[model samples]
Target chain A: MSRNLFDMVWDMHKVATLSTGQDQLFIGLHLVHEVTSPQAFAMLAERGLKVLYPGRTFATVDHIVPTDDRSRPFSDPLAEEMLGAIERNVRAHGIEFFGLDSGNQGIVHIIGPELGLTQPGMTIACGDSHTATHGAFGSIAFGIGTSQVRDVLATQTMALDRPKVRLVRLDGKLGTGVTAKDLILRIMAELGVDGGLGYAYEYGGAAIAALSMEERMTVCNMSVEGGARAGYINPDDTTVEYLRGLPYAPSGEGFEKAAAFWKSLASGPGSSYDDEVGIDASSIEPMVTWGINPGQGIGISGRLPRLEDLEGAERDLAAKAYEHMKFTPGDPVKGRKVDVAFIGSCTNGRISDLRAAAAVAKGRKVARGVRALVVPGSKRVAAQARAEGLDLIFLEAGFEFREAGCSMCLAMNPDKLLGDEVSASSSNRNFIGRQGSPTGRTLLMSPAMVAAAAVSGEVVDVRDFV
Target chain B: MTITPIRSLAAGRGIPIRENDIDTDRIIPARYMKGITFEGLGEFAFHDARFDEAGNPKAHPFDDPRFKGGSILVVNRNFGCGSSREHAPQALEKFGIRAIVGESFAEIFAGNCTVMGLPAVSASGPDVAALQDLIEAKPETEIRVDLEAMRVGAGNLDFGISMKDSYRNALVSGTWDSTAALLSNLDAIRAVASALPYIGGFA
Candidate 1:
């Protein structure tokens, strides 16, 4: 049988086809973070095993480490211990380590690409689920558990059955002021969170092509929330340009040779898909996740969906979302007050994201009583934003400018929403209690929209601010 | 990776954490949610609330070192939820939790335990409470989960669990490489590779 692009990619990466119908897909690159890796490496140590491919794996600290007080021996004893453990683990194992002290440390996903480590035509896995963000470079990237992490460490391979690939074609064009965050939110709302179960999403069509590399990353970063194991965009010139000269990228003559290979990873002309879902980009408006889960969303101009307006699983989920979010049925999601606004995460914290948010928050002052904070996705992004005076603009507007890390996105770090505070956030997912507060409500939106909300103290459309 | 379903565990008892959708985050808060080793995390299990105002180990009934050897953790539905943090299972395993019974578990959490040689079981509400009562009645009681029959049995209480056959086989073999095993037979693998004739052309 003629193999599909996914099949070809899977077959190309397979070290061995196991008996149970799952292939031991070679992981071209593996990223480990402070929180999940120390223990896995410890398991290896107990067994007196060494990392099979140290050059292929990289390590960094993000979770738990205090973004602000990053000095050694962190006040949180556990944080210090975790960081120390990874430091020792990487050093002893001969794997690359990006220490906070090394200036290369950042969220594993963000720094991977900026440092030119994450590349195209490769299979990547990390302990963190958002690792799919690497797919913007046309790589097949996904998250795995610790044992799987250990498996990848010991053999540079992961075991897996192939998932059905669904081509999500976004044709037409995005209307002005609509961003990639909105594009993903719209996709999630249409598909619901569980829509991609047992599948990988291949984002394509003009809308995705029209997006910048960073923008495409913003789209793929949320695939996990929609229940997909992985998501990717076919590599193109934009991807090649993004990889032209990163620290780890092939140099000079190697670059041209690599581009040709990377370009071949795209679906062939007239390639058929197991499933195809098309969307008119112009129809997707600025979107925000209204209730819990990425699927519970509404357009900027759309009304909050009523429990009755939903049906089946959606209705039940929506009712729960409403009761938890304390939202009224049929109300406009716009203008809902927000106590906090977070403008970072691997999802929407790239340098481009910071620039876009800063554009909206430049002259506008934050609303009284709104505690807005901007967290750069990585130290590199933070340094770039600072170079452009974006950090100053945010600080002048009353938003606390912070260092790089996942921050409030998952509340693994010190920066987290307190008590029952509802936040307007640029990060993905609004699951109940996901934002630190057991009852804290999260409303997800684009970076610019989050900035606008920070200034207005409510969920205001960024177009008006623009 | 290995998945060794419990041959049987001495029934364990403790005060219920009583959280529904007790995500992997709460199972082991994101801060302690690091490291590759499964050992020693049991002490830090539920560390956020396990410690009191002074960071001292609160005398929560379950925090007693006596329950440290407890084998079962009874939880609400949709338990072991949230992001695919494998450390959650590591923490549970480190704490000497031999088995976990919930109404449901997040796909990744359930799979993580299966790959880690641990048993994250699913059971009915009444059955879970009965196990809880046995623990509360005698905190040191050993609860045994019989993987051979897929059931958790204690004094006067027995509850069955359902699992995928692949996962069951993995526990027995101590290797979740069912995919690899299926091909272990030379003839079967030869048949599979031959069926997909185009595979050889790729290399």
Candidate 2:
């Protein structure tokens, strides 16, 4: 019998079934970042344990790094302290460190793929939720908490309960101005935020195959937002070609052998799935989240759902969103004024995202009184953006071309919102106070939509520019 | 590290959060998460909801005088949905939440809770709602969560609750730490890694 990529990879990595009825699975790649690793490292010290496989674990600084200044000491003492903790811990454990000086430093999710550390048919674990971003390469990658991080460090494995599989098949092709971001938002809206609780999503079909590697990453990156522990796309020419000649990828004859193995991991023709959800790709439009969660999104031409249209928990959440966002039910979201426009995160911070934003920002001035910021996902992304002069385009448009880091995505650094400023953001998670200020609001959209919002000083359709 | 067996949580006062989709950002804001450790995070649990910009107390259940010492948290569906921050569970645990009874929970959040020896159990929507109503009607109502029996009791009401069997087993067997159990299979882990093409560099 043929099996899907998830089952194949999961079975290959299963070390043992423990007495507790959980599988003790081996982790092929363990990615670590500053904010979540410090405590895990401390736990290791407290328990007198060392990293089981130092080489398999990679460390980077992202969440608390200051994108504005790469200076030695971050102005925020706590941020500097957190960075110091990771640096010391990595040094002690002999793990590879990607600091600002490494040129590979960016978000952990971005560097993992760009460096070829993320590959097909492997199990990847990270302390960050968006770690599912690695699944674009046909891997079973999921995020874990700090304790699990400690477990991965002390042992090369962690215990996990198996999740059933859901095949999210996207048919047809996306229309102009409709991107992977839009398609994913549409999927999340159709399936409630908690829709994927006990399942891993396998994205397939012609539409998924049509997406570029970066676009596929964007789709998988937000799987956690939909409550899926992990999401993945099967390996094909696009997946393997994206890994070609990368620093960490196998080379020459080894590459040939690895590519063949990866392709074989794809779901076979007769592969079975526990459930299947079909989506019409062409029907999706550029999406913008109207409420506190990513699932509370509507198309660019749509209006906020009236309270009466929603019922039960949905209605209660919508009422809370209206009260928090100061939005009127049935009011059109278009032309809603934005105080800030942010473009960057593991969700939409790839080089393609920057290029798309630059395409809209070129020769277009940001509206007066709008604070626009363009942050790359990684140092390499920033370098690539500079090579293509995307940075110049954004800078000329009155957007702050900042260094690579998480930046304003979660606002762990100095960059944050003031008062009740409304923002148009390309990052995932528009949860309440997600971008910093307790009262600040976030409207999640694609990078181009963010650029359009910045230029027009309000929520505008990106298709208008096209 | 010594492991502690957590069979059940005894009857205690309950805190009812009558909202849905209360994410990690709301449980503990991003600014407070910058610390290197999870220590002192209890004071910041539900910081934004329990306090205003000026730090004044808000009309939140966690802050109510009646539920001051509440050890069981009763919530609506999809609680702890965003950001796989362990700090969310850490904050709640430190804030004295020994068990959580909700209509449902986000996958990662529930797993994180399990690893920390905190049981995140689920019940039918009506059962959860009835429990919350009972707690609110009488703030002094005692709530108990029994992982061994797979049930939750509030005041005069007893209802069936559900959690992953693995989680329940780990809690009862005092192996919730998992690191010891996982490490015991180190040789098998190495054998599996050796068989993987990628791990061997496809050579």
lDDT of each: 0.77, 0.92
Tens-place lDDT digits, model 2, residues B141-164: 888888878888777899999988
Model 2 spans with C-alpha error above 4 angstroms: B1-3
DockQ of each: 0.20, 0.89
Put down candidate 1 lDDT per residue, A215-259, tens digits, no spaces.
999998888777676899888899989988788887787778777
DockQ of 1: 0.20
Error of 2 at B194 (Å): 1.1
Please write out the lDDT profile of model 2 over residues A21-137, one tens digit for every residue. Answer: 999999999999998888899988998899999999999999999888779887888998998899999999999999888989999999999999999998999998899999999
Q: How well is candidate 2 docked (DockQ)?
A: 0.89
lDDT of 2 at A420: 88
How does each model score on TM-score? 0.83, 0.99
State how far residue A406 of model 1 sits from its true place (Å): 1.2
